[model samples]
Target: MNAPARLRMSRTALLPVLILVFCVVPLALASAWTLVLLLIPVAVAAWVLRVGVDIGDDGITARSLAGSRTVSWTELAGIRIDERNALWLVTTAGTEVRLPVVRTRDLPRLAALSGGRVDVPAPPAQ
Candidate 1:
């Protein structure tokens, strides 16, 4: 099988994250307590910048701040887009696996990677 296609958050999305990190730098330097609080934005940045999804012939691998999980194509019940335009994977066990950093525009490539197991939603009418 071909190598998995990896998807990540857009670079434009990292601008706000970088700004927040810089804004928190002084606070983090001020005191131990503030330094402790700095972990929040750090984690958010890690999630935004490092999180990714890999789609291959065998399965889908989702990586987040927590960890990575791979679900085989056979295990997937279906796929759908939420109101927020996030793509979700529905497993046969009925669990909903949210694909982080996955936007509506990424669906076509994801569908191709899934070997057509996922149907790309039609664009909305004007």
Candidate 2:
């Protein structure tokens, strides 16, 4: 019953971007050309907010700045964890969808969201 919508990037991730935007304000006032500099942080902030993994009872969706793809539980062949701890969903079609902000540590969360379509090994007993 835990409806956790863990976005790909935490909202807190935007703090630095916001700071950069604010810091550029004075420079923007000094020269109109400097205003163009704001685009970087703005784009980064937009990316952070827009891109991410969305796990629901029926499927997992990988979101990007350009688009999103959803893989239903039945289409999920397996899960892969890369060297960087990034999570990828391997489909029956042999395609892979990288789940942003979803590392190996988040597998349990995914299992819970999957409602038993996914399984994770239980943590070892200490």
Candidate 3:
């Protein structure tokens, strides 16, 4: 692909979180110390908005709340699936980078974007 492919967490998940933030407003107003409670929701929203995976010409990038890391296609050893079903990018150096907002269902697209660097197994015959 000529342009980078971007995968992000669904914004719909933030709806309930935002409503919950509104619920915290009254309590925050009640006490000066309680105002600090607002940071919780703010951090959650920031996390949902900031975390994602980006596939470009150079390689794949994993972004988090505080920072991001990139693994060039040449350095990508493979992908790993944890017991919790999270996807992680394993580098040739043996370091693993968690890919946020990327699901197992997205493997085909990921493979395509990786230009065959990542492989997806063929389904079994019926």
Top candidate, metric TM-score = 3
- Each model's TM-score? 0.79, 0.83, 0.90
Ranking of predictions according to TM-score: 3, 2, 1
lDDT at residue 41 of model 2 (Cα atoms): 88
Better of 1 and 3 by TM-score: 3
lDDT of 3 by residue, 2-90 (tens): 68788988999799779979999999999999999899889999998889999999999999999999999999999997887689999
Worst 10 residues of 1 by lDDT: 36-45
Candidate 1 versus the native: TM-score? 0.79
lDDT per prediction?
0.84, 0.84, 0.90
| Backbone collisions counted per model | 0, 0, 0
lDDT of 1 by residue, 1-126 (tens): 699888988768778877888888998999877887688777877777779898888799888888888889899988878999888889999898889888888877888777888887676899
| Model 2 per-residue lDDT tens digits across residues 1-126 | 446365677789889998988888888778878778878888898899899887776688899989989998889999987899888899999999999878888888778777788888666899
- Which candidate's lDDT is highest? 3
RMSD in Å for candidate 1, one decimal? 2.6
